[model samples]
Target: MNSQIKKHQACYTVADYMSWPDDERLELIAGQIFDMSPAPSIKHQNITGEFYSQLKQKLKGKSCVPFIAPVDVVLSANDVVQPDVLVVCNPDKITEKNIQGAPDLIVEVLSPRTALKDLREKKLLYERSGVQEYVIIDPLEEYVQRCWLQNDGHYGASEIFGSPEALALQSLPEVELPLWEIFGLEPPEPAIIWSG
Candidate 1:
């Protein structure tokens, strides 16, 4: 241990994260800064795109707003995160810079590098911030796990959904979608061989 070596402190606030120059892909978790991985895989994008497409059609003229990734969701001044998908009905809450307050729904598409963080860190943050619903999307297993914030806590009454089931949301009642559609990928063909 060298006396001159000093560890860099983690960022705990949205302002702390936003202060950095562009090109830093990071998220603030309960006053801690975690470096995010690169872009998502093709499968991740496909599902996100598919879900966004459906939500757009279903949520038309509705109060529930459907938004995709790259949009900052500020849980608090000190806690700002960019969830994969977020819906905010309060137009007044949507600020010119970022989401000023908690949204109705927060969605996260899990990746290899972000699985643990998404399941634990992000989940805790969303719950504490009062997000109505938090969705954890796993493209690897083609599953979408929805975590409803009940009793002001997380990981309770969480629903894990798989194929043949449609996603239902209390915030967006018009959201009607099938599992196969969200994957938006063609199934593998049955193995066959030329028989004599």
Candidate 2:
């Protein structure tokens, strides 16, 4: 619980969120305000940048567009967030002020301060909002966890990928992420198999 909740008696909405100072880094989840202070670590930024760069390159000239954080993703009037990295395929959702709907893919690089919220509250929000795919990267652990929206409209069990593996995106079948490169790790040597 690194974030402090705003002490408003009433649940906040986008209109209230928009009225706040632009300098304040905050997120509204189900109308509750969560502070996003003490900016992320350098390692977090590095991993986020690398992942975004990879997605951008792979999605170049494609219908989907990639965006990094500080851009608002307005899931609903009261549910707005700024995911670390996101890809939105629908042009109509890309409004001048903010993204109007759930993005096709979202990536959140976990920091000590925001890990719990990202894994719990944000996960539920993204799932409920119909985000096609959600990816969580732990810079410290050098691993990734992914959740894809199931047929029944819920996220299925998370699929874990270690630093040595590549993650195939469900929302965009053409895209794959090199976890080693993303984590800035040396690729593990191939295991030598001997004939029995």
Best by TM-score: 2
As a TM-score, model 1 comes out at 0.85
- Scored by lDDT, the top model is 2
> Can you write out model 1's per-residue Cα lDDT over 1-196, one digit (the tens) per residue?
2222223765356666776655656676777766675788988888888788888888889877788888877777677788888889899888888888889988888899888999988888888888888888899888888888777465477898885577888667667678778876554455689999
**lDDT value, residue 187 of candidate 1:** 46
Assess candidate 1 and give its lDDT: 0.78
- lDDT by residue (tens digit), candidate 2, 1-196: 2223345447999988887777778999999988888899999999999999999999999999999998999999899899999999999999889999999999999999999999999999999999999999999988999999999999999999999998999899999888999999898899899998
Which residue pairs of candidate 1 clash?
Answer: 12-31, 13-78
RMSD of 2: 2.4
Model 1 ranges with Cα > 4 A deviation: 1-7, 152-155, 185-196
Error of 2 at 111 (Å): 0.8
Global lDDT of each candidate: 0.78, 0.93
Q: What is the lDDT of candidate 2?
A: 0.93
